[model samples]
Target: MWVQRVIELTGWEPLGVSVDWAVVEGELGVPLPADYKELYEAFGGGVFSDSVYFLGRDEGVSFDFLAQWRVGLSVDQDGKFGDVSAVDPYAIYAPGGKGLVEWTPPNGPTSTSG
Candidate 1:
């Protein structure tokens, strides 16, 4: 939760969070700069960008400035949780920037991953 708080205090908003932050791809996670945490909920973000199905570059994110689709995620300091499932544009205010999530009707929980 400390990680999430640090992100929010810095003014970044969380997009969504996966069940497990540890499960995020290593390559994609490794390249994130130190400031990445500052933009995460740990700083001040309210969104949850930790979902396994996050909608950003798989290789990495533009740490310098947030892209139109980039977002963050975090559990509150009290242990409460939040996600971006119902949020618009994930975190950005652009159109069609949420990418293409292939929903599989009402039967499968696993939607097609791009």
Candidate 2:
């Protein structure tokens, strides 16, 4: 229902993201690449508030926007496998506060899109 509402309002659809196993494995027990870490830091890593997540309270700022948010993800479950972790992708939807009146989908590309 909420996902339908979002599509109605923004025309963008919720896409099941694809993850690279090798890369995820690299990050599972070890640190991610330096450039990637820097990017996450730019997104406010230590903070998990809505403001630190682009799809949450970040409104719709581009990756170029310093206020934009991103997560330094690692060892995530993939569609290729049945289960890898406790995090259920279906349980996680893009959260936004301030109601529908103040929501804007990213105009350039999907959050994981380039």
Candidate 3:
């Protein structure tokens, strides 16, 4: 409903392909909101309103959430922004730890745990 309204208002086009939610959730390790899923299903992944860019799922590509998360971890590991611990307060070292965790409701506040 809301997604349709927004799409109608913004004139955004659908991706014309169904997404594999199970794989996506497995990769992210979190359940995405229905609205977000709907939006992604409607628009795929691309820039919206000239400011927002939704991350799309692409096998073996760097556009998916896992890839983007890895990029962040890599940047932190390289200490490009100084000490990793100092830079990433909420980061959960997944190599031998509990792994990173992020929880968010539909357009609600987010909670993170390592």
Q: What is the TM-score of each candidate against the true structure?
A: 0.19, 0.19, 0.59
Better of 2 and 3 by TM-score: 3
Best by lDDT: 3
Candidate 3 clashing pairs? none
Candidate 2 residue lDDT tens string, 20-49: 424432434333344343333333223346
Q: Residue-wise lDDT of candidate 1 within 1-114, one digit each (tens)? A: 555665467665654422222333242333333344333423323335664332332234532123323333322122343333424444534466755443332444433334
The numbered model that scores best in TM-score is 3
lDDT of prediction 2? 0.36
Q: What's the residue-level lDDT of 58 in candidate 1?
A: 29
- Expressed as tens digits, the lDDT of each residue in 31-87 for candidate 3 is 777788887788776665986668757564544766776677666774453434324
Decoy 2 TM-score against native: 0.19
lDDT of 2 at 23: 47
Task: Please give the CA lDDT of all the candidate structures.
Answer: 0.37, 0.36, 0.67
Candidate 1 residue-wise lDDT at 87: 40
